[model samples]
Target: DEEGQPVAAHIPGLPEGAAITEGEVNIDLIPTHKLIWDFRIGDLRKLGWIIQCDRKSAEWVRDRYGEEAYKKLSGKFGGTRTDGETEFEVNILDSLNSVLYEGVGDKQRVVTPTMRSNDDVQLDADKMIDYYEYWHKPTKSNPTGTFGIMLADQIMEYTPYPIDSYPHGELPYIPANPISVQGSTMGGVVRISQARPIQREINRLNSQIDENCDVMGNAIIMVQRGAKVRHSTLDNGAGNLLEYDGKGEFRP
Candidate 1:
């Protein structure tokens, strides 16, 4: 079982509720925001670790694992609710696909997946449970190329990271920029740094141009001293021409 509970004492060949259906398989894609992983300095298989988080409803967990798992997962506030259908978090850890390194006290435990028999046997579709197995890279220790499950990090489940094929067993994430200052690392350029200065200069120049145009664009007329000037003739935009009769200089 997913919770590490024993389903049955003894089994003949395949475990009970193990799905072996031979039809189109359904795959659930997880979002990237919920994923956490170490820096991809080089090859993905050599990286330290990777984690996938999944949000599940209380009813969904109860239906999949059982009532005991639901009670344990949901926090104190969850228990008070009349309806037992709140969302909860679960994490899946995939380390190098084959080897799962778990730290226990001072020592670490390297867990490998268990192998299944090759002989054909009858499969009961009615009692089958839906699950997916990840592709494993064949190593010296684990040459069988199989992935397994382990429990660690409070309640995080250890499983294989899903990939399309063995040739390109890369992590599911893609960085925005391929070029990085550090040759081994991956990142993109900081576009904001270049754009912000140019934007500020453009705004400053526009303000200066507007101030100069405003002073020179207005209309000003000159009138001689002691000469009578009619205010009605200066009506805004009335297009009345003014007549100045003074012989010397005029005041504007």
Candidate 2:
């Protein structure tokens, strides 16, 4: 039987209270070509690659002009409105029709649309690349393009670099040290103190505490020895607390 297929009947020798359970089987139809195509187009656009044209026209253009040219034209013609933003259909169809039938019988002729002359030129892949390169290093007449190129370059350069390249390392275990002490026994009271060298040290300590200790445990304190103590108090009774007392020592 297949891995997840259920048996027709359970075996009889099993324990009385035990029950046989079948594994769940999940099945789904593969996505259709239309769905895949739409998803791919959306993905490409999100990655700065443009895709446009209705399904039929897109297919025709891709077949005739090549995919590269079609993609370039899509970006170049982005946000253009040809039919009141509802449809891209244009009256240029009449011109194309006229150009096709202009030749009579017994005459061989070729007709091509005068797109550039009519201001209908679509910037294909080659043109877009050329434009970008030229914009980056422009001639005297193309100062505006040069300015735009400089601005784009500066913006990209100045943007904060992503921290993804930094490798994550396991934190080293830090031994806890005392920050303060308050007690009085036979000899006298001794107070100690210390602090984290930096904020990141504190963060590391907190992270370690969270990982190793129970939620309701004694608070872990870290202190450095020979740390200078500023002040202290005695048990239950008031006494003069020394400020910068010579008894406490400061270490680098």
Candidate 3:
């Protein structure tokens, strides 16, 4: 149940007619050890340790930005018809490319002979091949802020594609095992290395428990050190009796 309450089910063979009390159903919960080796599976799930892939481009944009932002962008930059499926059409890639290459033709791509490097290897930056930069600044009215896909010198309000804040406070990246640190958006740490010591201890304890159980599981008998008792008698008939006569104490 959403509230974590157990919902009762009435089986076909049950006495209740499509409505059974909680007591009527038997809930047999298997032990965690019997089901899985790692008890931290639940914790890992809660921490978002699962594989996922997002193939939908439109939904991806909608998820990062708000629905209004997606609609605005979709209208500003029309989607391409994908195999006659206009409803599922997406132009996110085209929009991004267009934004990145806003003033590509305006920028001077061919460098003069003097501007060329000594090694005759002219880099893209040296040729003045500039691309539009994406900017977003938060305001009191719009907490998500306004988006601007234009040149570095261009102002947010002056951009042609003016959209509101990314209401969905999520970055355009797959969220995995992430660690949070103050004054940092993303932090890195070796999770396996961090858990190595604890895992080693758990393994050692489990090994010790198994060894102890194996040794202690067998029946132990105590008798006089000098006493004589037939070892074969233990496996003999149920009523068979074995007597020890000596005085010194012994343990097996």
The C-alpha local distance difference test score for the whole of candidate 1 amounts to 0.40
lDDT of candidate 1 over 1-252, digit per residue (tens): 222233232233645666433468565434333335556534454533345443334565558657775455444112112111212121122222345475778676557563442223522211211122233333334333344322222342434433223223333334342343565322233334335689999999988877765656644565554556664556433333344566665423
Off by over 4 Å in 1: 1-27, 42-49, 76-153, 156-252
Model 3 error, position 217 (Å): 4.6
Best by lDDT: 1
Best prediction by TM-score: 1
Candidate ordering by lDDT (highest first) = 1, 3, 2
Clashes of 1: 0
- Models 1 onward score TM values of 0.28, 0.15, 0.17
lDDT of residue 198 for candidate 2: 61
Q: Which ten residues in a row have the lowest lDDT in candidate 2?
A: 166-175
Candidate 3 regions exceeding 4 Å error are 1-67, 70-193, 215-252
TM-score of 1: 0.28
Model 3 Cα lDDT, one tens digit per residue, 1-252:
122222222133545334333345443322111121134534321221111111224454456556775555443321222221111113233333334222466764332122222423532212221113333333333334333332113221333212222222221122244353766532343334346689999999989977775665644454454556565565322223333444454223
Model 2, 9-86: lDDT tens per residue?
325465544544446745422112111122443322122111122222334445655777556555443222222222
Model 2 stretches astray by more than 4 angstroms: 1-40, 51-86, 89-95, 106-252
